[model samples]
Target: MTKKLFYNDAYQTSFDTQVVKNDKDEEGRDYVVLEETAFYPTGGGQPFDEGTLNEIRVDNVEEVDGEVRHYVAEPLDASTVNGVVDWARRFDHMQQHSGQHILSAIMQDEFGMATLSFHLGAEIVSIDLDATDLTEETLEKAEERVNEVIRDNRPIETKWMTVDESNQYPLRKKLAVDEAVRLVVIPDVDYNGCGGTHPRSTGEVQMIKLLGWSRQKKIVRLEFVCGNRVLEQLGNKHKVLNGIKGLMKRPEEALEQEVSSFIKESKQKDKQLAEQMAQLLEYEARDLASTAGEAAGVPVIERVYENRTIKTLQDLGKKIVEQTPSGIVVLVSEQKDQLQYVLAQGANCSGNMKEAAEKVMPLIEAKGGGKPNFVQGGGTKAIAADAFAERLREAALETVE
Candidate 1:
């Protein structure tokens, strides 16, 4: 196994280690394995460390079998090289991982809640706890306890022990492995077996902020941020609040009430507009019914509109047929590059409107279905609107014959 330097000193930013293996994988990606490395591989819910190995950027790090491979863009020329860890990223992970430990421990100690799983994301960290519901009071209490522990500046220590030696400390959770257990301990507070890197003291986590929690079945997943991330989140929220205030031309205190009032007024205007539109459509339908031509002793109305919606054509067809009980209404609308059509017959009409729709639909390769009295469909505008309407009238007359 490669010597894990990060486990010894999480603060180590640079180290000198000889390249044990330099090779290119099947995909032609260059990778090097160092005899000892301060770079932490991606595992235990914490992401891998990124930096330069012999000045070549290390894009990814993974442990396969027993070796830690540093995937790089270019292969190193020298066998002996310096490895530098990206301190900013490494420290950020340290803060998040350590903060999770304290928060998880306090949650269990105070509420008997067990952390089922943990995830360290780019902007946030979350822990899945085994609880049905997490109330606001419970969350605030746990957060208060966690911050108090951080303020105490409690020392965090790591101990490597055999499977038998691990039983001595009061572990918060059971160890997954039977041998070679490494315990991270905050004395008299928390003890858990973890492979992820963490800070030397609880204070290094800076501050742990529980952003929110969501329910997942019987568990509650708590989202949080630590250290520099907390300040970043606050800055972003403040920026958004200021933008909203400017847009509304109101102070932050009055923005909520102003937005609520605006929404109510807008909804009222929309309702009034809908009522006026219904009245206009009713008048238009009567005009079409009166002007319909005779088709085999039955009234027929055929017309094509521009830029109208399929729903509008449907509504007009329904209204015209209802007004003229012995009539057939065939309305088409050209919207964008397609032609939409609707066919409807009055309650007293003897013709099958479905047959008329079937005949005209195939002219434009359309698809639709309806009862014998009403049908609707749309397809490519292969024929002109006037020509299409003429064909539809002929089809309806044929149904009458």
Candidate 2:
């Protein structure tokens, strides 16, 4: 087993070590096992420490069999090398891990909830609780309690004890390992077995901010952040709020009212605009019907549009029939990739528009349905829009007879 120096000094950033063996993973990736290492391997729901070995970037660390292998950017040529851990990343992990321990302890103690699993993400940390349901009041209370413990600045100590000696203190969970059992103790607050690195005291955690929680599978996954992450999130949110305030031309205090008023005004304007467009479409329908061409001794209105919607076509067709009580309406819309057409007629017209559409449907490979005087459909452009209009004109005239 490689000697893990992090267990002795969690704050150690640099260390002198000798490469015991240069090994490779099953995928032929280069890794080196040092006689003693300060890099923390990936385990205990905590990520591995990233740093440099002999100034070669250490990408990952993991325990294989009994050796802690450090996967490197390039295989080390020197037997005697210096390892430097990235302090910012290591400290951030420390703060988050310690915060998780404190939060989990409080949830188990005060709320009677057990943390089933924990995951430290790139921007946030999440813990899956045993219970599927979590309410706002319960979440708020838990958040308050954890921050209280963080503010207390209590000492966080660890003990290396045998199985018999571990039985003396109250442990939160059962021991996973029988030999070399390491227990992390928060004085009288919590005593749990953990191999992950952490800060010396709860105060170093700074603060823990709970984001939210939701039911995931059969458990509740609660998300949160700690220490510098809290500051990062606050800075991002402040920037977004400032941008919104500037766009709205409102101060911070009045921003909410300004946004609400803007939304109400926008909705009213939208309603007015819709009403105006409807009136304009009605007028257009009447004008088109009045100037329609005659076919089979009856009026036939034919118009082709580019990129118009089926709903608009239907509305215009309805209005045209309402205005001209004895005219047939044939509307074709050419979209970017497909062709759409509507066949409709006035009440007094004897034209079977459905029959006309049925003849056109097979030509365009289209699907449609309607009554004897109304039918609408669209499909891929099997034929050009102009040719389709001519075919529809001939079909409409035949149906008029």
Candidate 3:
């Protein structure tokens, strides 16, 4: 079994070890075992360590039982070696993981919720807690407690004990142990059996944040960041807000009120313009229907217009049918990318407009339906307006005649 130097001391930056085995196998060449290693293995939802052993780089690290297996990309001389840990990556992991530990502890202490899962992805870190709603007051309380633990600067302790001895101590979860169990204790704040690298003291965590939470099956998933990540997020937020203010021609401090007022004014103008447009459409529809002449006792209004939507065509059809309560009114409108068909009949209409619409609609690959008198539906640009109108005229004549 390879000795785990990281479990004993997280702050250990360098170590000296004798190479036990070296060979050139399928994966080029690499040393098999080192007497000591500061590289933490990939376990406990944390990533593996990466650094250099002498001049050769350590590519990957893994753990089995208590042995740490280092996978090197190349072979180094079979002699004594010096190993150096990537302090930057190691420190980032330490800060993020330690911050998570404190946040988890506070959630359990305050709300009796257990952490279901945790992930440290490339862009964000999140924790899933087994609870539903959490009040704003509770959030503040939990945040305060976590930050207090960090400020306490308690020395983080790691110790190895027998399975039976480890069972005596209170743990956040049950101990899954066989031989010696490694316990990481944050003094009075937390004590859990973990096999991961951690900060020397709680103060090194720097900061803890509970950004937001979302509901899952029966749990709340939380997104948060700490230390350098928190600083980076805040910096990005400031840059975005400054850009928005410049685009709107407003001071950053007044952005919220300015946006709100602008939205309200825009909506009011839109409503007024809609009313005026409706009046103009009614007048236009009357003029077009007059040109179509009257059929039987009612006016057979059939006309096409551009730059009109399905809703506008239907609205104008309804207005014309109400005004000339004698015959059928058919309106066809085509916009840049779509076509619409609307057929409206007065109460004294001779034929069933609904049946006429259904029979005529399918010929154009469109849809049509009505309340026994008025029928309306539309289709894509492929549907020809003239073909649809002629078919409707034939159906209407059969019903009305």
Candidate 4:
């Protein structure tokens, strides 16, 4: 087994160890096993430590079969080498891990909510509690209790004991392992089995802030930040708020109301614009109907539009048929790489619009369906839009016969 230097001192950043084993995996990635290491492997919802091992970058660290394997970019030349852990990352993990213990303890003690699981993520940490709901008041009270413990700077002690010996302390949870149990104790408060590294005192966590909570799988999942992460999150939020204030030309205090009003006004303008656009399409459809050509004693209004939406074509077809009672409207439009068309006959007309659409749709490899009076479809732009519109006109005239 590799001697875990991190267990001895969570603050240890540098260490001297011998590379006892150097090997490559099936994928040809190089990994070295050190006789002793301060680099903590990922475990207990805590991530692995990253840093340099003898001037070579260690990409990942994992404990496999009781050995800490440091996956590095290159193998070390000498057996005796120095290992350096990334202090910022190490300290951050320590803060969040220890903070979770305190917060989880308070949640159980105050609200009788037990922490079901935990996750230490890249940007934030979260704990799954056995409670169904977590209110704002409960979160506030838990935060207060957690910070009180931090302010008091209570000593965090660790002890190795057999499974039976651990029962003497007031353990918040049961031990998962039967032998060689490591218990982290907060005097007169919490004792639990954990292998993750933590600071010597609660004050090292600095503070624990509960961001929010949501229900997941019948449990309350609480998202929170600790120590330096709290400051980082605050800085990011302030930056975003300042940017919004500048864009809106409003003071910080008035930004919320200003943005809400802006959204309301923008929606009103959109509604008005849509009304005007409908009026314009109606006028255009009437003009097309007035210039319709006679085919088989029926008015045929055929037109092709550039870059028009399929909905616009459908609306134009509806309006043209309304204006010309015996009219057949064949409207085609090119949108991007495809050609879309709408075929419709006035209510007074006897032509089968569905039959006309069926005949022309196969010619252009199109797909659509409708009743006997109206049909709409689209297909590849293999032919020009005007040519496609002309073909549709012929099909409608054929249906009249």
Candidate 5:
């Protein structure tokens, strides 16, 4: 087994090690196994450490086949190289990982809530609690309690223990590994088995901020940010609010109320516009009926348009037929590489609209069927809507005669 340098010192930023083996992964990517490494591999819900090996970018690190392989952007030619960990990223992980320990411990102790799972995400950290009845009041209390422990600046101790020795402390959760049990203990606060890295003390975690929570099946997943992440989240939210504030012309404190008012007003205006459009469509239907052509024994009205919805065509066709008894209406609209249409007839008409629709469908590869007096459907623009409309007019005159 390769010696683990990060196991002992989470704060170790740089180390010198020799490449034990240079190998290629299954994908033909070059990787190296070091004699010893300070780079923490991806494990225990924490991401892998990113930095450089001899100035060559170490894209990923993982324990594969009992050896910690550093997957490099390019193969490392040097036998001996200096490995440096990105401290900003490493420290941020520590803050979130350590803060998770505190937050989970307090939830279990105070709320009888067991953490079902934990995930340290790139932007936010989350823990799924077994509790179904979690509330904002409980979160407020839990946040305060967790921050209290952070303020205490309790020492975070990590040590290897035998299965029997681990029984001495009350662990928050069971150890996954039985042989080499490693426990992260927060003095008298929390004792749990975890392999992920952490800060030196609770104080180094800065603070725990519970952003929000939602019920996921039976568990409650709580989202939050810790340490500098809390600051980053705040700054992002401020930028969004500032931009909206300028657009709304409202003070920061009054922005929420003003936004709510603006949405209400916009909805009202949309309703009024819909009403006016409906009245205009009614008048347009009358104009179309006045210019109808006589086919067989009924007045036939047909029009093709671009970019009109099938629903609008159906409504207009129905209105024209209703207003002019014994009249036939055929409306088609070209809609981006396709065409839609509606065929309708008023009462006292023997025109077989369904037959008329069938006669023109094959030309456009369309499938439509309706009663003896009405039909509606659409298909790809294999043929122009205007040409298809003429075919329908001829078919209708034949069906009626």
Candidate 6:
């Protein structure tokens, strides 16, 4: 069995070890197993260790049937070699995993809930609780209790005991022991049989935060951070609130009411602005009717707008086609990352609008349409404004023919 260095020190980043087993696999390539390792193998929903083994890249690390297997980029000599663990990633994992244990233990104790699932993701760590109806008050209480445990500076103890001995204690999880069960005890808070790495003491956790909670299918999902992550999250929130305060020309504390009022006022003003804009477009449509010409007695008018929303373009095209006698108006607009078009035909156009859109849209990889009177769509392909404009013109002319 390999000596787990991380078990002794969660902060251990560097170590030197002797290559205990050195050999090749089925492909006849060389590999080496160290007598001791600081690497934390991928386990308990936490990611694997990432670092260098004798300057060789440690690509993957895993524990298989009681052995920690380190997959390296290349083989090393079967002698003494240096191993370095990525401190940032390792520490982050420690914070997240340890925080999870404390949080899970508290939930089980306080609410009579079990931790159904736990995940240490790149963005955040989440724990699913078996209980439901967790209020803000309960969450705040849980956070306070966990932080109180951290402040108490209780000694964390780990022991290898038999299954029968472990069953006698108030363990959070069932002990899985063939010969021995490794139990991590957090003073009076938690006692769980686990192989995961943890901090030496409760105070080493630094902080425990309850980010938020969501309920799904009778389980309450908790999202939170611990240790340095709490500090990082605070820093990010501070920066964002500062920027928002500057934009609103108000102090950060005054933002909640100010933002609320501003949004309400802005919505009212937008409604008025939309009404006026629609009226102006109607006037423009009438003016556009003069330029509508006929090909085989079916009038056609093409209009271009700088940048407009798809709804606005569709409304304008429908209005123009309704006002004109026999005209087919094609309106095109190019917005960021998209090209939009609306085609509306009055009583004069002889062909179907949906059929026209179907035939022409596939050419530009676009999607959308309506009945014989109106059709609207945008190109899915990332096309330049000029290229999309050209394609729109081609599609319009095909409809006219």
Tens digits of per-residue lDDT, candidate 6, 287-367, equal 888777665566777766778888988877877877884677777787766678887788766656666667667656888
lDDT of 5 by residue, 170-288 (tens): 98877767697888999978998888898889999999899999989988999988999999998998899889988988888898899999999999999999889888889999999
**Clashes by residue pair, model 3:** none
Better of 2 and 5 by lDDT: 2
Candidate 5 lDDT at 282 equals 91
Worst-scoring 10-residue span by lDDT in model 1: 392-401
- TM-score (C-alpha, index-matched) for candidate 5: 0.82
lDDT of 3 at 314: 83
Per-candidate TM equals 0.78, 0.71, 0.62, 0.79, 0.82, 0.80
Tens digits of per-residue lDDT, candidate 3, 109-179, equal 77798887887755467888989877788888888898899899988888889878877777888877788
- The CA lDDT of each predicted structure is 0.90, 0.91, 0.78, 0.90, 0.89, 0.80
**Model 4 C-alpha lDDT per residue in residues 123-234, reported as the tens digit of each score:** 9999999999977788888899899999999999988889999998888877778888999999866899999999999999999889999989899999999999999999
Candidate 2 vs candidate 3: the lDDT winner is: 2
Candidate 6: which pairs clash? none
Instruction: Name every residue pair that clashes in candidate 4.
Output: none
Q: How many clashes (backbone atoms < 3 Å, residues ≥3 apart in a chain or on different chains) does model 3 have?
A: 0
Q: Where does candidate 5 have its weakest 10-residue lDDT segment?
A: 173-182
- What is the TM-score of candidate 4? 0.79
C-alpha RMSD of candidate 4: 4.4
